[model samples]
Target: MPTGAAQRPSVSSPRKRRGRAGLVLLGLASLLAIRIWVMEPAVVDSDSMEPTLHPGSLVFVFKAAPQLSGIHPGDVVVFQSPQDNSMMIKRVVAVGNQTVEVRDAVLYVDGFAPDEPFVDHESIDGTHFSLRRIPPGEVFVMGDNRERSIDSRDFGTLPLSSLQGLVLGAGR
Candidate 1:
């Protein structure tokens, strides 16, 4: 080698390169598993959850939350739309075996109305729905913007099996 010449860096061995590629593949597989069984990112596509979640908003859905903490009324969840199997986000208003009704645009569950500060009641008209019982293993859901949302009121209660995850939070 010439004394004043710069030395070239040695190339990594083929075995080392293959090992690094395997590690990269393993890392990617782990991430895919986590997204499938732990958490996932979803985008809101409608005004259904306005005042809480807006169109184009990004949200994280915790897929294991329901199994870890159980589903309850007032919980925001992601589920498959019964009509088209498309994804949707909504709040659980009535759980299994509960009776639900809407009178004068007010929601009543099991003969008592729960406080819904998230709902946009100003846009609601004289909506009246007869009482219906939620069957075991099913839940009734509604959007915060009830006036513009097509939810359980239109499609009826959904089976718990249709639920995909719980909304942990939203991002701008």
Candidate 2:
């Protein structure tokens, strides 16, 4: 080498570059798999869940939750709207074969009113729904903000197959 000449910087070999790229691809694939079969993030787009889940709230939806843990009354869940196929979030009020009714703004399951502290009763406007029996494979869901939410009262019961996931928790 000539005196005063600058030395060239070391370059990564092709094998090393390929290895790094392969690792990145593997990591991405793992994330995709988890999202598809395990869990995913969802955004609440309406005030239907009000005190429990507000509009623009970010929540974690565990896709495998239903399989691991049975869904019951008071559980928040995500599903497709039967009317327009849009995504919706609501709390399960009645399970399969359960009779649900709302009289004078009070919710009744199997003729008994369950205490729901999360409900926005002030927003309820004398809503009265006749008794409806949920099918063996369906659930009745409703929004905490009843007056503003279009839920089972409007669309009837939702099949368990339509449920996308269970809302585990909220995020900032």
TM-score of each: 0.85, 0.85
Give the least accurate 10-residue stretch of model 2, judged by summed lDDT. Answer: 163-172
lDDT of candidate 2 at residue 108, scale 0 to 100: 95
Candidate 2 Cα errors over 4 Å, as ranges:
1-18, 170-172
Worst 10 residues of 1 by lDDT: 163-172
Q: What tens digits encode model 2's per-residue C-alpha lDDT throughout 69-151?
A: 87888888889999998999988999998999999899999999999887767767899999888999889989888888899
Kindly report which residue pairs in candidate 2 clash with one another.
none
Q: What lDDT would each prediction earn against the true structure?
A: 0.90, 0.87
Off by over 4 Å in 1: 1-19, 170-172
Tell me the lDDT of model 2 at 133: 89
Query: Model 2 residue 161 lDDT?
Result: 82
**Model 1 Cα lDDT, one tens digit per residue, 8-39:** 89999999999999999999999999999999
